[model samples]
Target: MSAATVSSSPKITEKMARESPAEQAQVLVKSRICNPNFIFSIFSNPPDSNYSKLKYIISSSLTEACNNSVLLLGPRGCGKVAILELVLEDLLEEYPDMISVIKLNGLLHCDHNCALKEISRQLCQEHQLLFSKMASFDDNAQFMVSMLRECGLAHKTIIFVLDEFDLFAQGKQLFLYSLLDAMQSVTSQAVVIGISCRLDADQLLEKRVRSRFSHRKLLFLPPSREDTERLLEHILLLPTNSSFPHEYVTAFNVKLLKIFADYKFKEIVDTLSYSDSTVNHLQRFLFSTVSHMDLKSGLLSLENFKAALSTIQRQPKLEVLKDCSILELYILVCMKRLEAKEQELRNFNAIMKEYKSIHDTFQTSNYYARNVCLRAFEHLLQRELISFEDNRGHGQSAEFRPVKLLISRPELYQGLKSYPSCPVSSF
Candidate 1:
């Protein structure tokens, strides 16, 4: 049996190796499209050209061993962090020996004591110093200051990346004060780069803390429709100068361009633009598109895009209904029937009455007791599929409380269409 299995493995390997050149090219194309770094590399900077400004200012500051501070402000998923990271990554590669990076997030180290301890830990790890947890905040702060002074003497540039900077600006802001104060007091070549979603993050700082800050702020905004279109082209269009075979690249690009021109594809892109016009959103959308590709097709299509877009834009209520029990769906259907009759005050009792009428009239099998139906009704209420009127804490029992269907008529119809054995017609 072992010998037979060994022999059969080669057959499997041979079958896998039989994939065509086009299929292999498609695999590479999918990989490139899904690669966040590759996608970010193709990022079209805004008209203000923040990417260049970041690269130039940070690079020049590092080169001169000068201390500088900058804040990056933007809404979440607006590529503020991505742009900064790309610039920092390139700079680190260029000056590997000269640069040492320390990353801190306000979510994790917003407290002054925690920030100090984290600074000590990161500093010790980066410099290969034996780290001992300090017994007090003062000891930790002192150790960090000494470490910064030592780093300066060694001609090393420390780059501090503070994410969610607004959180760190709360309370006494001892973390910000000590950090900015260190930049002024010590001779260390350091760059304080703060990234925050809050546009007014700078204004949150105390006067003492704000005084120490360099006051340079960069604002990031969502990509425009034209920018989003350009991004799509860069992501989906195969580069002519790529290492891929000319025929494969040309063929893929042709197909991609045709897809781009298609109104359906354009509409999908437009819909996404109106929802979340971010690089991250576009990548997520493409991730779904690539997920639908297979060796047989070996190419992306409008159908794949449509399916992916539909998945992303699916209704939450419909999705919830799909996961519901048949009994629960029955309760929903009862509510729907009651709604169709334009019944006022469709409370749990009223809905249960409608359910029994249908059950008796149709003589439906697999009968659920009133208690089971009540439990299902309560579940629907929990999911907010049904909501109670402002009659809570009244003398009436929970069953008599007036409720309304949260879902629309069309949603009920669509949700039931895909549900197996829904028995929607029994109503």
Candidate 2:
């Protein structure tokens, strides 16, 4: 086949197609996962009932401190993006003629300069008539100032919602300071709504910027297990005729939801789908006469679970392993490592070294090994089971240190105990 034709072909195998309905349902559900957006759309809108609490707070701010900024700080996946979308919808209704909402996700632009440039570019493109005279300027900061001037002259209010504000706070202190200063100097009535994973006390905004936002309300949202369960139910209710069994869903709630509650709703859905695939694969390995009930409990048993681990370890190539849902394996492996060390936190280097030793003994590189390890780390981080600290200075390699490990998987940890450690600490 031509390269183009080969690339266009479906990658999943025929065997995967014949998997259990539950497994297929998991995959179908996750395949429809949506990337969080800032726009106010029908699919993205929050339930009206959830808005009452937030509306009062925002309305109070708009009435009392029209010029000051509001900062919403919370843990990741605590509905910051949803709240912003809801607020945007509210702004449209409450201040239709007077205000315009501009939303931006900071993570999309990795660099400070690039972020500001894009923001300016977007504003100019969005309000071409108002900014046509100043469009020739190459300086983004200057362009932003001019745009603010125009907004002040024409609109009663302009609100800028900076989502993922923590990304910018990490190394873009100067950029934030300058933006705040420029906003403060604007003749037009303007305010900012900043959303971040860290609270204001934990953030490093400059004194001036901090003071500017002082009068504005600061709301902190912490993730709750209840919210996660509710979110799962919401997702399961999406498909018109989803065949995901209630028993399977209940198992997910008990075994996975609590452990992974800190993850974004989408992340949790992806992990569950991967786990379902793992369960399906295990079932296929069993004899045809074995009841599905026996297979289910067998896969959950310590001995059979270890056997599955062995199967993963014996995989000759990473490519094959990756295609078979290595994320589930990685999670199991990480849990096992934590149990073996009896440590609350597993250093990144230690985990990588252990994996290298295992690979060496097998005389092969598992294609998904490195990526699986990283995904596991990300999962722990998302769950707040681990806190990763990257000590590398700017433009240097990042070193990861896991601060904690939540769930314990003893079988996986025992498997790693047999492997020798690698020399490099990069992992």
Candidate 3:
């Protein structure tokens, strides 16, 4: 395929570059192991502002061997988890024997008991300590505290990293508060890092819980266009062989079709920071291009890339909807209905009323207070499932422009009808 076929190019999304194991290790750039730019895709400037801050925090915390809490905040697909992994790498090297790092994702351990049990399980697995599973929350809580305290008294550094941190913010504050308290204790040289997609997740904390995490906070901004472009280039370049040229043409049916984006595929690269659809589609194109690369020529020609592209079947992305809460699903139902009616710039109050109407219609016992509805609205906004325009107005007259549905509204609602509490069950 040539450039004409993919004129509107899209960026390489997180799923494309970072997650897919085949692409993660092999498909990306042939850059050397030591190149800092290529080391982290979409991270253009080595030691940029956020990097420097995070590096400094890691260095300071390591050198001091004292308790420190850091909260990393960023939007989805923005690389908060990556930064934490980098920090963990440093820890692995710097204090192999003296430190124990436990990484937990809030998504999987949303329940208070689950989180506690996970901690105990991991500790035992790591050290081969055979302890009976604490059956009760109190027992588990005490078990976790005792283990941490023992580690601290032994002059060992304990690090707990919780990603998707906002989930933990909603339930009982005990786990969070306890972690922070362990960190600050005079005997425990522990560190707690909470990575959240919410910019103001700290607000969800009780005053006491909030106080522990107030020490350090860093927000990772989305990567820029240039950074993204370079990231793709770095990831694409192969030292041994070229899969395809930056631009290529393919023969589709009887005509020559250009399967390219961004003119030079820049269009595809530019959207990396914002669009997941673009990423999903582009990943297929790249994979196809690479697979069709000629072995003897050691390069992928337009013919090879196109032949591969022609065979790829596009798949629907409905997993996002499957992961929505009941409240969030109802909110999506409301936004979708409003969008179907061509209603634009409706404020929160208007959406809330619509949501209630839909909720009541469902004949379910799900109860969402106004605050809960608002929370779901904000969460939906963050996920980019629903988007609204700010009319630059606030208070009584604030007009929130049309709530646009990025995902297939009909499909999402169908998923809801089939399984409303799919994601909530995990919590």
Clash-forming residue pairs, model 1: none
Which prediction has more favorable TM-score, 1 or 2?
1
Candidate 1 on 224-283: residue-level lDDT in tens?
A: 877777777766665565444688777777888899889988877777766677777777
- Top candidate, metric lDDT: 1
- 321, model 3: CA deviation in Å? 22
- Listed in order, each prediction's TM-score against the native is 0.70, 0.46, 0.57
After TM-score superposition, the amount by which residue 388's alpha carbon in candidate 3 deviates from its true location, in angstroms, is 14
Which candidate gets the maximum TM-score versus the true structure? 1
Q: Give the range where candidate 1 is weakest over 10 consecutive residues by summed lDDT.
A: 1-10
Local distance difference test, candidate 2? 0.49
Worst 10 residues of 3 by lDDT: 248-257
* Order of models, best TM-score first: 1, 3, 2
Candidate 2: where are CA atoms >4 Å away?
Answer: 1-54, 60-65, 105-115, 130-143, 153-155, 170-172, 199-202, 215-223, 237-427
State, as a TM-score between 0 and 1, how close model 1 is to the true structure: 0.70
List clash counts for every candidate, in order: 0, 4, 21
Q: Candidate 1: lDDT over CA atoms?
A: 0.77
